[model samples]
Target chain A: MKLLTLNFLTCAIKTCKTNSASFPLHPRDAELEIVEADVNLPFLKNILPRLMWDELRGICTELGLPELPATPPTPADLIQPSSSTPETTDAAPIAEADEEPSQTAKDLHRVLLETCIQEGKLVCGACEHEYAVKEGVANFLLPGHLV
Target chain B: MPNPSTPAQTYETNHVHTVYEEIASHFSSTRYKPWPIVQTFLQTQPQGSIGADIGCGNGKYLRDKSQVWMVGCDRSTNLAKIASKNEPHSVIVADTLALPHPNGVFDFAICIAVIHHLSTAARRVEAVKCVLDLLRRPCSSSSSSTSIFTSSATPSGPGGGGGDDEGGKALIYVWALEQKDSRRGWDEGHEQDVMVPWVLKQKKEKQEKGRRKKGGDEEVGAEETKQEGDKTFLRYYHLYRKGELESDIEQAGGVVLESGYEKDNWWAIARLR
Candidate 1:
């Protein structure tokens, strides 16, 4: 699992739904890997608003990776087509140079898209439930009593 | 494994899991492509929508659509591993009866070719309700307006103010025992709950292959050896009759928005009210 996905998950216990601590499960003994993916800027731009930046940063810190900024960049800054270039400012029908993504956008892309946890355990804060991650798939099946 | 004294349901669950694990690789290869009907259902969703695929073997449906955040889960760990290889960080090993997600978290969901695996009527009903439970209501702030309003039948409200304008919607598909040319004419007393066999092809060892003489002699020998090594694995299936799927969903508190037969399978798009 990627650190980005963990941000959206909470303890599956019924009562844990309302407990704030149930979320943002702390990563323990995490083994991470980096795989190259075709960065879809449009997709990243679309999902930015839904991500909880603080939760993402917290997990990144636990995994010993680069931290996300306190404030994520505005969706417009990421989505706006680079129509105005430094060369012409408003050039006519000429081939334009590819615009480089901002430093913040690159950092977000690395943490959210490039990195994945190969094996680990997600420890719940409220009930202290431990979910194991193996072969990149988290086993979330709780005991029959918990269910 | 369940003892003989245990309920038949427990034994059935064990049978399904064991068979899937044994044939995970071959099963995944056979299911290389998603059904076209399922692809159309996915295309209807807006970009950036959070979607879940319950019992998502091989994650075949989690392809090409770059805009949707698709999460996949399955009871089989081996199949989940193959799926996660393609979609790292998005697959989970989970049971459909007790999914790991919180209520009303997913904007949309799909459970294809899954419900029929349950061996009993009550188990099928439980599986259907579990899928419905994962869906977020249509009126939830995150849902797309186009999805709900497009349906012709507007379900009555659980909310006083015209009810909650939205309930969760899902597409469910089940295998049909006697649809089209799928089966030979059935006798009067055909069983609904049946054990279907999956035949696994076995590879012969070098010594065995070399022992065979050359020419047509080898051909006859190979045919006989093939029969000896063929392993047939049995899986429990409760094939849905026509109208049975829709009835199950409605019985589970889902409002049937639309339902019909597609290809050899029966499917329905329902709103959980």
Candidate 2:
């Protein structure tokens, strides 16, 4: 499962739904793999504001990846500054298409879309219930008792 | 055989989940065509909108929109494995009533042809509530993040978003009881609970070998022998009567925005009330 998915997932237990600690399930002994995918800059920009930055940063830190910037990047920060001349400013309609993705966008895409957990267990902080991830598919099916 | 007294989960595990697991590949091969109503719903979501496909068998709808991010979940692990292959979308093994998603966060959700498998009325209503709970709650203040997308101007269809404050919408589909014109010919008075059989034919090579082992003289009992090689699994379904789906949504604290019958199934698009 991608780290992006972890943002939305919580402990499946009904009782844990009210617990603040259930959201952002923590990864344990995760075997990470990079599965390359084309970067969709517009999508990254659109999803940027919705991302829970602090939780994602904590997850990255837990996984021992490099620390992210203290704050989330704005949509403008994700795009490279247009290098076109003043003559091209008149072609405003097509200018948006010409805007290139910056290095931050690529890194963001790499973390959110490309990096996948091949095998691991996501431990719910509230109940300490572990959901196993195998072959990049996280099993969120709770046992009968948990359900 | 599960009786009326059997637990809904246990009954579904035997009659629904197991059947799908055993026939995942064959079932997925036959279910690639997206229904027009469902196709339109997925296509109209704003770019980069996040959604969930509950009980997404083989993830056919997941491929409908590349601009939106969708995460699919299924009770059957085999089906989830098949659905996980859809790029840019993830699939996890999860029960509908116990979905792992946090409450009130998704932009949209679709539970296509899945709710009918729950053997009880309460469980079915719970399933609808579960889908609604995944949606973003209605916001009184117009947040900048949501207002930034001007794509809402796209032509609104039957269940498309028309109001900004009405949270996320969920499209749910189920087999209708009033499908007299369909191949099954089931109508209003027919038994709503029925076991539908899926026959998986034995491979020709296997059949041929079995015949050869029986030594060509067993013609009298050939039909019985052939039946032995072929497997038939019965899956349980509770066909929805007209207005039942809408009622369930209402009972689950959802408001049905639009509903219609399509190709023997009743579907309704709903948002949390």
Candidate 3:
């Protein structure tokens, strides 16, 4: 599973349903890999607004990656410095530019696109629910009673 | 620990997973088109957001845009493999009832034509709750970072926000009454809870083997009368009525933002507050 996926997961325990701290499962004993994926700058721009910008920054910090801005980058923030197009680039529109991707865009690309969690365990902070990650897949199933 | 016996659940799960695996390749070819509602929902989302498609048949939603990092998961490995090959998103083999993600993690989620496949009404609600749980909730006051849902909900005004803190939103579609409309030629007699049949295509090798066996028989048996290429597999489904979906969302503790029918399909947009 990609570290990107860990953001959405939480303790599957029924008791944890009302527990506010059941999320952002802490990755423990992780085996990380940086795999090559086609960088979609437009997609990255699109997800910024929807992402838990603080949580994402925390995860990157935990993984020893670059920090994300406190607030997600807006359309104007993402405009490529070399963008010669009259229309500004936002998450939706990918302006054709001769220059390289902006530093922020590159960092976003690395965290969202390249990082993969090949093996690890995500232990919930509140209930101590341990979700095992093996071969890049996290097993979220609880025992019969939990369901 | 000894596992509890759940024959009904086991049988239903096995049946549905098996059918999908059997027809995954064929199903992939037929699922190329993206649903308009889903596309529109995606358009509203911010770029570089993370999302998941539960029971994503062929990862069709992943191809919509690049800004969001989408993951496609299904209980069937065969379908996940096809999705991984066909779409750019990462694919995982996981069950919808118990997703692997931490609670409140996504900006948006898409569960197209997935929930109705659950064998039981209780499970259907559970599935919705599970998706709701995966959405990212709001942080406490001390946190400097903002939940994307809150940011997006800002434009809609305070009252319009889907949920208090679990602002992550979702778009869910299920089998609806329009499928049974008389003009569509579907049998109205079909019950809401019933096993739907999927015709399996015969492999060439199997056809050749059957031909050899037929030559030895003096009379063609009635049991063998089935067309050489056609075999039926029963898959379970619990179709939802017009209001059942919104009711389930409410029952699951979700705040319905908007809901209604589009032809035979019923869709709901809600926030897991």
Candidate 4:
């Protein structure tokens, strides 16, 4: 029993590679597009939601976007930033401290563009789970063989 | 959520989780603190607490706790779909207004940064009522069954600040959309309310900037203004005082047995009266 236990321990030590970041089984960055903001809302009422307003607006200010509206048009029936369409080639838009998107009074186009960014797809990092990002929809799915 | 399916639900469901990314990033970014609060809450659960994460976003908080049974629910189909995609298990898609389970089913329910997201008072009331309705149960020997409900939120105002409910908050949010007409002019008072978050946000930014100047994490993204400006933002988010919240619990048929701040935000454990 002692010999067997010793042998198992020795084998385990030899097989267990300390660094997992280099392992083939390690997860990879799937680089999936994640829509972080609603740029596709109907024109009239497209400012950020209250939940998103402050954080986004603050970030906008720091990055230099037009100040977002305190109260924005309530476009209820507007099309949600819905869809599974991923920005195939569009780079994840990053907010900056210098660019202003619009000059319209109380307009938040610039801030929306800045506070928001496309989120990365959460693939297995190992399995190429193709989660598509369209209008902010993420589809983390697995192929038949991989499941 | 339906019962366990035959071969177990795999990853072939749905995919978009920017909500998750942003949510995780927001909390991870020091802008939000629900995760830490969740840890402490989890630590104190009495092994057998029937737990549920209201507006769970995706089972992000569902962890390996054999003692606690957890149910994660969110209102957004897009969110639920993404959550379903990323989660190892299936997440139920339902509105906060409707929960497909029996009353008194859970010993505790957690609503994390959820109340303020609602855009109207009616919807907010309905959502709260629904949760309360489910929580109300009959007892064996006692006259009434009991349960607990907990929520975390920030203060509402021109510079709507963030904090735990213990410090008390008056977070204002549109409970629901009342009309489809685009003609009604936006109210200025509401606009003032919006100012609160902006003001609070500015203050937070100044602090963060100061920290960065003093050797804080500069990698923190500083480019949200442009994008956020175009977004229809929250008027304000105010947290209620702990005592006030307990009274709210009492009104809803519960008792605020334990209430305190967790990470500057109010966190309380209240049982139904």
Best by lDDT: 2
Summarize candidate 3's per-residue lDDT along A18-57 as a digit string, tens digits: 6767767778888888877765555555455445667678
What is the TM-score of candidate 3?
0.69
Query: Residues A11-61, candidate 1, lDDT per residue (tens digit)?
Result: 767688678788778888889988667665555655675566777778888
Candidate 3: TM-score of chain A is 0.80
RMSD of 4: 25.5
DockQ rank order: 2, 3, 1, 4
By summed lDDT, which 10 consecutive residues of candidate 4 chain B come out lowest? Answer: B167-176
Candidate 4's residue-wise lDDT over A1-147, tens digit each? 000001001101112223221111211232222223323222222122212334334434443545656644344332333245545557643222222223332234333322222233322222233333333333222233332
Total backbone clashes of candidate 4, pairs 3 or more residues apart or in separate chains = 86
Give the least accurate 10-residue stretch of model 3 chain B, judged by summed lDDT: B216-225
Those runs of model 2 whose alpha carbons end farther than 4 Å from true positions after fitting are B1-6, B142-150, B153-164, B204-228
**What Cα-based lDDT does every candidate model obtain?**
0.70, 0.82, 0.67, 0.35
lDDT of each residue in B150-190, candidate 3, tens digit only: 44433321222334454568999987754655233343445
What is the TM-score ranking, best to worst? 2, 1, 3, 4
Clashing pairs in 2: none
